[model samples]
Target: MKKPAVLLAVLSFIILSGFTPQTGIKPCYLSLKKAGDLKAGTADRLLADADKTRMLVTEAGEVPITVTEGYRIIYNNKKKAPFVNLIVELSKPENYEQDKKNVLANLSYLNAQTTGMETTGKLLELDYNGYKAYGLSRAGISEGETLGTFVIFPGDNMIIYIYFNNIEPAKGHFKNAAEYQGYRNDFIGQYTAHLAKCK
Candidate 1:
């Protein structure tokens, strides 16, 4: 129930997990913010996650999928190898009604032309703190060489949006993805394990 306890639990999870990130280092934190931020308390809920992940038709023949994931690593297949670590995916179809409708429609149209690309319907998912997350992406789309990715943190007090390439594009500081597992565990999955919620 306490933040410290939660922080410990998250650290334990990361360390105990069999698979280690590339860095071989584990993060330790109950929430995204540090102790000071937790004690201060901040506003919660900015743009509430979409009520639903549905279908919408887009102008182009391409159908874009919308979804979320806990501690997910989106990699582009075309590049050299590991692809890029997506921080914040802009134009994530943030529009509520419009985005939902367009995403659904695009899915159908794309399905007809491509195979193995059907919306499996919540294929990979994670729901925590009344917040449900899904992930959306395609294989061939190019991510360019991210060579970028520093810190992927939360905005406001509600969401953790990862944003890289702040000053430059395609070229930015690199944040070892392996080091963030601890932060992911505590922040994501089930409940607010580390940070103290507003009283």
Candidate 2:
């Protein structure tokens, strides 16, 4: 299947029953550009791409989920492909709390959805600035290239997903697991700090 299809399949599993229609004032999209050494794409372009992706996923008929409110931003380096991608999905406050409590269960469900093309590493439990978080490292099964780390955490009424991919490993961002962990941690800290200012 295509990359979007594959991504939708995985996201379908992660968000199938996790989001509910929320009423009242919607959260505003964060105005963030530079986080650590990463720079983001234009807000309009990122939002348009996210909307297109959502429409495609909804029309695919593979999943019965609809992302009513969210934002997707691609953080790039000098490379063409994004080095890190951020997805902020809003949910009801109650659902957010529940999801936070059941993060492990959710991660297990996500792990089961991984296909033969991808191999997932051990789940890394994290305390992201006092917010409960989890990280899963994934790579291609054949090439063994570092795909990225999927770092998940809960916000007030939203779920934050940070996909940290070192597309330009030749630039010496990270060479091994330990180095990757350090790099991801630094990025997460900087990114979350930016998020703290978001309303």
Candidate 3:
């Protein structure tokens, strides 16, 4: 289908639904970007080729899901150390808050995957972009630091996962809990504002 037609259908669905963001402003619907426009890594050296970024839109667990559009940003010139990756995945789900327990469990699985790290603080919960989310902080037992923020955007039917970790094994350090929280707030705020402008 053409972009405009898909967009029209999406917008109609959202506007007609009773769900609304916390601000009570409904976002004009649009894809994150056409796949061709995405560029990863520094201009000097390419890390991820835009043409290779592929996510199939399909049904999962009886929910009709489609990955309308999305993008990925990879930091550190593709090196695994001190890694950071920001990904935006916009999808349309059959129902809001569907299989919420399973969703949370998936996030918990990621938390368990971290190795050689000690919990630095309690799990941080948030009401981000009209959705319930949480974050976790951990420090390396003998090397690096890490912070992971998981956001489930119910209104938008999107899940944004941010993982920030120190690349330097011996020199890595995670700032205070407040600093991580600030980062989360800023990201969610900017994304919500941008969505409001979509059309």
**Per-residue C-alpha lDDT of model 3 across residues 152-198, encoded as one tens digit per residue:** 45455554555655444343232454553454455545445545555
* Local accuracy of candidate 1 as per-residue lDDT tens digits, 1-199: 8999999999899887856623211122122333211121222222337533334454464444333322323322222223233222222325434443454354345344443321344222335555443332222222423212122222221223321111122432223333222223333442233322431
Question: For model 2, which pairs clash?
Answer: none
TM-score of 2: 0.58
Q: What ranking emerges by lDDT with the best candidate at the front?
A: 2, 3, 1
lDDT of 1 at 176: 37
The estimated TM-scores of all candidates read 0.26, 0.58, 0.44
lDDT of 2 at 36: 62
By lDDT, who's the top model here?
Answer: 2
For model 2, residues 9-35, the per-residue Cα lDDT tens digits are: 999987975786445223443467776
| Per-model C-alpha RMSD | 17.6, 14.9, 11.4
Query: Candidate 3: lDDT of 129?
Result: 52
Q: Judged by lDDT relative to the true structure, which candidate is superior, 1 or 2?
A: 2
lDDT of 3 at 69: 45
